[model samples]
Target: SRPWRRRLWDAVQAAVLDPTNGLPKELRAQIAGVAMAVMRECAAEQPDLEFIAEMNDHFAAALWR
Candidate 1:
């Protein structure tokens, strides 16, 4: 499970790495949708506050930019 989570993170990272793909309007919306769902689920678990904060910040920065 951890490994798959890591893989998913990796894929997300890769997907956003390229300015071309990352800058596309449609792709940005899709990424925001997926990240929002993930962040909500992650926060629902009442995880370590620091980790949750970090994850939220990460996703927010990506989606907002």
Candidate 2:
């Protein structure tokens, strides 16, 4: 079963924040940066779908590039 979005976000933030998670420094920063943006948007009363989609696109590009 898949985890909920909130749970997934928690895991991602933990990995990015943990120094011993073993992710490369640059990669961790990238993930943390995107997570922060997404978190902020999600906190809004009415989250913007377009912004979330754009962030997803950018993150996917970074990952696949």
Candidate 3:
């Protein structure tokens, strides 16, 4: 289950890093807004501190790259 989650996360990260260039601007913004909302909800649920920290680190690293 953990491995599956990791794979899913990797796939999402890849998609975020390399989004479809052909997507309309409005559609892209809508997608990103929804994604952020979902992430915020997950954060609010407070599942695991370590997992949150790891995800934060991953996003931080990706942003820097």
* Residue 37 in model 2: lDDT: 74
lDDT of 2 by residue, 1-65 (tens): 12243454566778889988888999898888878777777767777768877877776686798
C-alpha lDDT (0 to 100) for residue 17 of candidate 1: 56
TM-scores of all models?
0.36, 0.64, 0.42
TM-score order of candidates, best first?
2, 3, 1
Per-residue lDDT tens digits for candidate 1, residues 1-65, read 23333445456655765567737777766765665555454546453446645765776687788
Pick by lDDT: which candidate is best?
A: 2
Q: Write the per-residue lDDT of candidate 3 for residues 1-65, one digit (tens) a residue.
A: 23433443444544654556565767556545544544554545444546545766765686699
Point out where model 1 deviates above 4 Å: 1-22, 46-65
Query: RMSD, each candidate, Å?
Result: 9.3, 3.8, 11.0
The lowest-lDDT stretch of 10 consecutive residues in candidate 1 is 1-10
Query: 7, model 3: CA deviation in Å?
Result: 8.2
- Prediction 1 global C-alpha lDDT: 0.57
TM-score of 3: 0.42
Q: Which regions of candidate 3 fall more than 4 Å away from where they truly are?
A: 1-20, 46-65
CA displacement after TM-score superposition, residue 49 of candidate 1 (Å): 17
TM-score of the candidate numbered 1?
A: 0.36
